[model samples]
Target chain A: MNDVLDVALRLVAVFVCFLVLPLVVGQTEHKVMAHMQGRLGPMYAGGFHGWAQLVADGVKFAQKEDVVPENADRRIFQLAPAVALLPYLLVLLAIPIGPSEGAVGQVVDAGVFFVLAVMGVGVLGSLMAGWASANKFSLLGGLRTAAQLLAYELPMLLAAASVAMAAGTVSLPGILNAFAWWWVPWQIVGALVFFTAGLAELQRPPFDMPVADSEIIFGAYTEYTGLRFALFLLAEYAGIVVLCGLTTVLFLGGWHGPFGGDGLGWVWTLLKTAVLAFVVIWLRVSYPRLREDQLQKLAWTTLVPLALAQIALTGIVKVAIQ
Target chain B: MREPTVVAADAADYFQTYSVVGVLAVVGVLFVAVAFSANRLLRPVVPTPEKLLTYECGVDPVGEGWAHTQVRYYVYAFLYVIFAVDSIFLFPWATVFAAPGYGATTLVEMFVFLGFLAVGLLYAYKKGVLAWT
Candidate 1:
């Protein structure tokens, strides 16, 4: 009975966090990006920097007519968004938001591996959306997503392997407890590679060829409308949150305070994740979109090679120190 | 260091973690379902023939909806399979590398393995398989 209650409570926690965090961060991303681009975004929605802007957008999306393309595959088209969003929430389960102790999500021995594999599944959702649409643009977009995501996944895993090597465990909290300040310096190259490949994997700008608005007219999502479109948007924002969370745990030492003691350690985790989230938004605003060829070249030629070298470097350092 | 209040004491406890994951997955699907269903309830569904037509920049879509895609896509998939196999060996090698007895020998062996893959990558590059144009 106690175990059932425990699992229930954790489920509710995951639900609330999964739904709310993305909405909040996504709204903040709009305001931040607007400011960066020299405009006032969402000023009239709810006043005070448009706190209710995201809610307004939600209601607007809900009220809009749901349009299905006449030629599209109805079943796969409808299923794609849920597939995209659900795996990300599953990732949150293994992520230790607070500490290794009470008030955390599930702890698996293969946490990092699980996160990496599940995140890779998100590409399938895009592929389905693109293929099911039956539009040439969607097909092209889907193909590009598959190529770009699969290529980048290699580098991301390599970088994560370096951290796993350094920490000697694939679990999130285990990696956290493995180091103090030195982990960052030791895995800095791995962190950079991970962050870069993560941005590409998430299809953010500078690596967002899959949905290049100018080229493909929003790509796989071109034919989607109403709540279906909203689901895709939600998935993208949720992905940003998950990537930020993973970066925080893997690179920044999950939930550890700088002063060497735990004081509402989840607060520290949130702060680090917020900073990373801001950086993600900042990169979106600052960089121009890469062409498809450039995106593939960057992933395969540059980042993968860099990640391989970083792993070799990590191995040498570990052997010498021990 | 303070002990973590919740620890997996046995195999039973460890397996319980998967149940939590199962619960979360259900919740996620339910969340999407509710959002979609709510939209269906509150929104007016007055779809016209024009609205349901495929979007093609205000121009009528020409040719079949399904078009031929570039062959480069398949090439990328093939290359990913090679690297995927290579990285599979890498993850376990990383974990085992840091163990006390397994040091320099493992390192050299893994590098030799990587060296062979590197040669494959080099061949691909030389063959222009990685090129976009």
Candidate 2:
């Protein structure tokens, strides 16, 4: 009874946080982007720079349309968004949200691998969404996403391995506990590789060519509209948050604030994820998406090699420290 | 700069701990329920022929939404997965290789693992998966 109740509570929290996140942390990115572009952001929607903009967007998407193509698979079309969104929800179950004092979060043994494996499975949604749309553009989008995800997943995992070796555990908390010092200095290479891989994983700008808005009208998501489409978008943003959360936990030390002490652990975790998320959005607004061929070259030639070297360095660090 | 509490807890035990906390589950269910319900009540609905048209690069459908895509796309994805998984497994093995007493056994296990990984690479190469043309 307690276990079920506990699971329910955790899931509910994830949903709530996910809902408000765009309004909170995401607002920072939007405001920053707006200031950069010389425009006022979101002031009309909820007053005070559109605080309720995301809510308004969600409400609008629901009643817009839920079209099913004449020849497309009905079941798959309906199922696609759900599939795409499910992994992100599941991914939340294993991440540590706050410090030990605040919440008993960060559930799971081998949190690092567990989070990545589940997150990687998000490709299924892309594949299904693209195929079920019965649109070539959507199919191309799905194809592109699957390839992009698979290409970068390796380097991301390998980069995490460098941290894993230093920390000597795959558990999120374990990785946090094992931090001899800040992971940024010695682990900068792995950190950079991981951040780049994360862009490809989230299909963010520069790497977001798969969903190129102008070229494909949102690509795999073109066929979707209304609430279902909104769900997919929410899931995408949620996945980014989860990715940043995982990245922070794995390398920055889960909930342990910088300059020592875990008292304000939750603050550090939130702020760290927010900053990373901002940087991600910043890059999106500033850079152009890579061509498909260029994207592949980045994964195979650049990121993979960098990840391998970082992993090698990790081995040396482990031996030297001991 | 700040670092998280980098302490080692039993991997399995940590999971047991998060389950005891009642945060994430709460947020997930409440928001999903609200998202769907709010749409049901608040949004207006009036469908039209124009709205129902299949999207074609933001224009009216050209010929059909469903068109044949290149088989090469699928092949590339498959090859990418094989390489990704190989490296994924290999990295963990490498990390564990340096753990004091486990070197010899880890090495043997790794070789066996590498053997499987090698076979897949060879198959893909033989099938010309890496070739763009």
Candidate 3:
């Protein structure tokens, strides 16, 4: 009984965090970023810093009519938005948000495993979204998104696995707790591999071959607009937050306080996660996305071989440390 | 150097953990309800046909929105799937190979696994599928 209810509540949280928070953040981020670039941001939407912009945007999207192309597959067309949104939402289930501190443990399952399994399934939805989209652009975009996911997931999994090995458990904070002693000083390579792989998985700059606006024309998101587009944007932001959170947990001693005590341990989780998230956003703002061939080569040739080596090294490290 | 909560927290060990997802879902419902209610009460309504047209690339008229795509892309995807699974086996075997005690067993197992990867690669090679111009 509790299991069912827990699932329901998690789903609801997924909607709120992944869906709602971003709507709020998007406006602030837009303003902050624009100011950084020496330009005006959305000032008229609400009072200070356009705080009410997302809410206003939400109302606009909700009141706006949902459009369907006359020739598009109606059933599939309708299903695509929800399908694209679900895997990302499923990601929230395993995504540890709070601190590597104990509080996050209460909210998640064996979070690392849960994250990999659920997050990996997101690609399936991307594949389905493309196949269902009758539009050629949308189709190509979807397929590319799926392919990109495949290319990145391999290395990301290896990196994540290495962390799991060091931690000796798949528990979110367990990975952090292992970091309690030098916080993965023994597994620096593993952390590096995971960071690179994670960037690709999140489809951020230099790895965003899936949605190269200059080339494939917004890729899988070629068809989305208004609230649906907003939903995808929200998922990406929340996913980034979760990605950084997981990384901080796995490598940065998570919620382990400065000297291995506890007080506002959750603050460390958020701060570290936020710092990593800032790096991602900074990278996005500062760099151009990776080219398709370059992206594929990094994944298949470089990262795959590197990840395999790391896996081997993990075994070697395990044998030696014992 | 002693635990603060360890002695006191033991009393709560047998207590049930709160439903994480349930708590989150309730939060989501409340958020949506508030947002929707606010929108209904606050936002002014202004509806007209001009506000509802399919806004294209700054163009008014165009033919129907359907186009044909090449079948080659789908073919490539199919090949990717077959190769991807075949590629996954190599790493596991590689990992198993490193441990000292399982040498001969690992070798035998890897060969058996390699047989499958070989078959797939061979099929792709012979069919001229791997060659991308």
lDDT of 3 at A287: 82
Arranged by DockQ, best first: 1, 2, 3
Model 1 chain B worst lDDT window (10 residues)? B1-10
**Clashing residue pairs found in predicted model 1:** none
TM-score of each: 0.95, 0.84, 0.73
- In candidate 2, stretches whose alpha carbon ends up further than 4 angstroms from where it belongs are A1-9, A97-106, B1-50, B58-63, B91-95, B103-133
| lDDT, candidate 3, at A275 | 74
Candidate 3 residue-wise lDDT at A296: 63
| Model 1 CAPRI rating | medium
DockQ, Cα level, model 3: 0.13
Candidate 2 lDDT over B92-131, as tens digits, reads 5644676788655654564465456556655765776554
**Candidate 1 residue runs with Cα over 4 Å from true position:** B1-10
Model 3 deviation from native, Cα RMSD in Å = 7.2
Q: For all the models shown, what interface RMSD does each have?
A: 1.2, 3.9, 6.0
True contacts kept of 3: 0.07
Pairs with backbone N, CA or C atoms under 3 Å apart (clashes), candidate 3: A9-B21, A9-B22, A10-B21, A12-B25, A13-B24, A101-A255, A141-A219, A141-A220, A179-A183
| Model 3 residue A247 CA deviation in Å | 1.6
Give the winner by TM-score: 1 or 3. 1
Q: Which model scores highest in DockQ?
A: 1
